[model samples]
Target: MPVGRTRPAAAVFLANLVVASGLAHPAATASPYLLALAVLAYLLGLRADRAGPALVLFGACAALDLALCAVLGVGAVHWFYALSLIPAALLLPWLAGRYRQARLALVHEGWERARSLEERQRSVAEQARLRERTRIASDMHDSLGHELSLIALRAGALELSPTLTGQDRADLAVLRAAVSDAVGHLRDTIGVLREDTEGEEPTAPAVEPVEELVARTRESGVTVHLRREGPARALPPLVDRGAYRVVQESLTNAIKHAPGSTVDVGIVRRADRTEIRVTNSAPPSGSPPAGPPPAAGRAPGHRGLTGLRERVLLIGGTLHAAPREGGFEVLATLPDQVNPERVRSTGEPREESGSPASRRLAVARSGARRRFVAAFAAPVGFGLVALVSCAYLAHQLTGCVLRPADFAAARVGQDRAEVARLLPEQQFRYVPDAVRALPVPAGTVCAYYRSNGNLLDRVDVYRLCYAGSRLAAKDVLPG
Candidate 1:
């Protein structure tokens, strides 16, 4: 058996030995077999989780033990002691074992719960770090990419100077080439920083006003329109930055995909929310669509929009990009007051329902609750069973007890029917053989009764001898 099983077994054996030492009288030859049998019964009870089987075993053992005691001619004290063994040796040990099982189950469940929480915390932390890193990478790509584009544009303008030397023109060409190479390197670095995420956010500290952004796009040869509504008040940093990004990405997409197409940008700031809408017309009839279509026709699969959506969502906002009419449109709505910290703290996605660890923890917690209930309920069940058993035994013993007055009233040669009126309904079954062996008249059958109703005493017993139907004799045997 496992160690857990073994300890209860040892406890049961020791309890049985304690009971047997006081009650199980050795045979005349001083044999120890009866004590061994009592110990075995106690161990058996400890191993039985159900009360039905354990109670049955205990009842059988008690019957067998009392029978042995009667055959050996032991006293009423031995009978009482043997009966005490039922609760002390068997039920107590069984209850203790059950309690131990519940305690162990609860401890194991506690450990499982702790492990599950730790794993979830680790997952949340890892996801938070990844999000932060991707956002930083996106910021670098936007700010750096814009600066490099301006440098290349300036270098190109310098190359067209009227009085430029060949060496100066060569230097301008080299600077443009270097700027292009740096843009490629920056794209590669941004891809690395995005990890598996489709896109990232922009973080340009220098705020470019909407008018300036429109002028810059016009300089790049893109036809653009800008409109603003509502009060022109200072916006939160997050909202202002997000608004700039929406316009910047929209103009960039228009320049790449709908070159020479008319672009319209609208910004409407209400008391509660800021709305941005960007739309670009179809390209010239012969021009092919520029850049690739978003994967599965989804906005998030578009790299720029994916990062844009992330940034907008972090600021408690929403973004939508899709093809509309003969042009593409991007719409964004941002709340006036951003709570990015709250969003970042709570936005980490989790798979509690689908996670194996979560399921295991749930099961462990359920089992622990059940065990706790069993721990409390098992003892009460045992007490009820014991109480009923004791009540039944008390009833049976009460019926078998013979009062001293009834024994004294009996006379020799009285009719059996007349003597029967003074007798209890049942005989005391554990009357010692030594008493039974006492000399009596020939051809007499004997019936025994406990001398008093007291359950725990070793008082004398009353034995009545009857021949056929007549009371042949009556005697009080020493206990």
Candidate 2:
């Protein structure tokens, strides 16, 4: 039904006529219906599932064309002319059919491959998202757990027997219980939310030293003072870790708000309590606040300090973060016995699993390989077909003789059938003025047999006059 498909058949029909125009005694009067029928045959051949019918149709047209030329009193068609017509009638339709089929196969394969690649990319992205979320949750547990436990300890340490009233002791007990419950709830919630990421065991991070935290802050161009009130060699593992985080967060805040100010960091360790205080001299009052994470110019997110505060409360700690006269300070007091359970992370970094870049290379290689093979094979196939066609044509044309010797045996009186046998393998025709100039016997046919080669080859022709069942005269013409 598509116009594009029918156009080639119509074009082939017109081309067949154009090629025939250069032949001897072209059928300028070739019937329109016959030409349409030939085109229809070609189209049918193209549409047929099998090639046999199409080949038969082309062969039939070639035979019928020769018969028509003889019946029309025209000279024989040259072999080269036949060759030209064969490609128009047979080759084009055959190639078109093959192209149509191959195109369909390529389209199907392309669509299928494209869909598969799309799914793979989508899956990779989803996996990356899940992996990052799991890491974030694990990081929160490590950084915030100790802070919460300190809050409960601070509440339980208050004494109301002599110095505090009864109501104050009851409130302290309620606050301690509340902070403890919140820590358990937060851990359970994060654990349930991370269940879908994987079923892997957790990895525990190494405990960080407080001195390393101060050194990193100094490297970032912050003037910092470190003062320790007691020896810290015997600190518990969790308190040592939490003490480092408190310093890290405080120094990060200092750099963000007071880019070129001096900060004083003091750590005091005792048998019952440990205190960490970080105070930073404010920058010039008119200066815009520095690279705090919540600012638009940086990677901004919700204040993780709220979660930090929650962590401190669960571990019984008192944290005060406020702006003093011309300076900002974050102070935390933690019980020496702060121990909230540590959960390790088993989730690996996304890049460690496999690279998306490597997968992209594999996909690209497959696509390129298919296209390269197709690109190389098509031209080779067409060239070989053309070579074989030319070879077949040369062998067929070689069988004919186009010299004076082809009709040398014919005499003035010979059986017509015998004289015909002696004639060259081609149609015969009368010279233009043969009817009036040549003397021909009655009830006989007189004609000139053209023995001409294509384009560059010169050949001889012969004139013959036949009467009844015998050849009355014959003459070999000039080349």
Candidate 3:
């Protein structure tokens, strides 16, 4: 399904079909009908677009061929030509069909691949859009929320002023109430647009969490009971960050909806993992009104625990936050190494206990080389064999149109007209100097005549070496 992957297979199939057909060399070496057969092969297999006419056309060609062989007298050349054509006729069309189907499959696969890439691109763009919206929401909540709170503060203080009349005081109180309601409504609206599932940062704080993170929450007036297990030790950056975020979000939630709640925070460290647990008692400030949950949380409209869920899950941790025993509890367990990027500089690379690196690399290279040969050897090997076969057939098929018996009437003092009758057509052609230099004298004008199968199925050129209208040497020469 990769781009341009179908080209080699199609090319090989097409090359085999063409080479095997023997139509490339259409000289006398190859039968004239082969060219016709080549045309028929492609037309019958591919161009006709219907089977009935193709079969009829094939039958007609075969009948005509057999009749011609019977009438003209069959020979080695005829048999070889017929033998070669049989396989090509049957197999070339099938090869053509396979090639056409493979091409279609390749095109369809390419389109599907393009569609998948487009889908992935759209998904990436959507994620970016959502991330931008989250950033914008966070920005609005921080800056605009502060300004709205300031407006309510100023309005409330104005209502307490001695210079203000009863109606003015009433109007100031109403303005403060409206501003408070607007801030609450803005928080709810922005919360809907924010999606915390996207893990923006791959790595978190590159150090262990100090006591200060928990201390700050307690300072906000929540009674937090802290519990610690195992010897206190520095954790991996990913695990450390995941643990801190769990405590941070849980404490924040307890303070927001259930102020004065007794929060019980626990941290348990082990060789392979670190765990964090936060539980809170029934709130001294009393619980807030029930509402619909945000994305993933026990209570509705609680975005804090929902955001923490993503943070915990991103670090390959498990988190559970729900109401338990008339109070809320959040628990998380983080692994020491979530991913390769999370491992610290001091972390040792894990390998198979006794395997050598050189051995592994050598094995991989051997496998790759074997695969390369397996992929390419067949096409290359077949092409060589096809070329050799074609060349040999061409050699056998090629011969002098003249026969050795045609030169039997030539004599030492034969008349020119008589000799001319005995000579084959296309005589007096050029001959090589190696044989021409020996028999024919320099001053005597000479004529070249070629013949086949006089010696070892090879072509021999006969030169009627004449001197003063008398034959001097009429010896057989190599072509």
Over 1-479, each residue of candidate 2 has an lDDT whose tens digit, in order, gives 24326564444445454444444444333333444444544455445455565456456556655654556555333443454444444455454554454454455555666676676678766765675675577466545544554455445546324678898987877776676566556566665556342422232355667787677556544578999997655655555555666776676556544645788999987768899998989675554233212325532111334444444554567778878778888788877765333222222222221555545545555644554454456456656876797775444444344455656667778788777676556543323333235555567776666555342353455667777777877766554
Better of 1 and 2 by TM-score: 1
lDDT per residue as tens, model 3, 1-479: 12113333233234334333443333333544444445435433433334455455445545555555556545544545544454455335433543454444445555655565566577766766677667567446534553564465456557678999999998987787787677667677767877755553554435335377667545544477888997777666666766766776666556445544688999888788888888988865433221222235435325555666766676678888789998888888888777754332212233333444434444445544543453356346556766897676445334434556767667777766666677655553334445555645666766766666342354677777667656655777776
| Per-residue lDDT of model 1, residues 427-466, tens digit only | 9876666776788888989898988888776578888999
**What's the ranking of the predictions by lDDT, best on top?**
1, 3, 2
In candidate 3 the C-alpha lDDT for residue 39 amounts to: 42
lDDT of each: 0.68, 0.56, 0.57
Runs in model 1 lying further than 4 Å from the true structure: 1-131, 144-185, 198-223, 227-244, 256-260, 267-276, 283-302, 309-327, 331-379, 416-421, 424-426, 437-440, 443-445, 467-469
Candidate 3 lDDT trough over 10 residues, lowest sum: 344-353
TM-score for every candidate vs. truth? 0.61, 0.35, 0.50
Question: Pick by lDDT: which candidate is best?
Answer: 1
* Candidate 1 residue pairs that clash: none
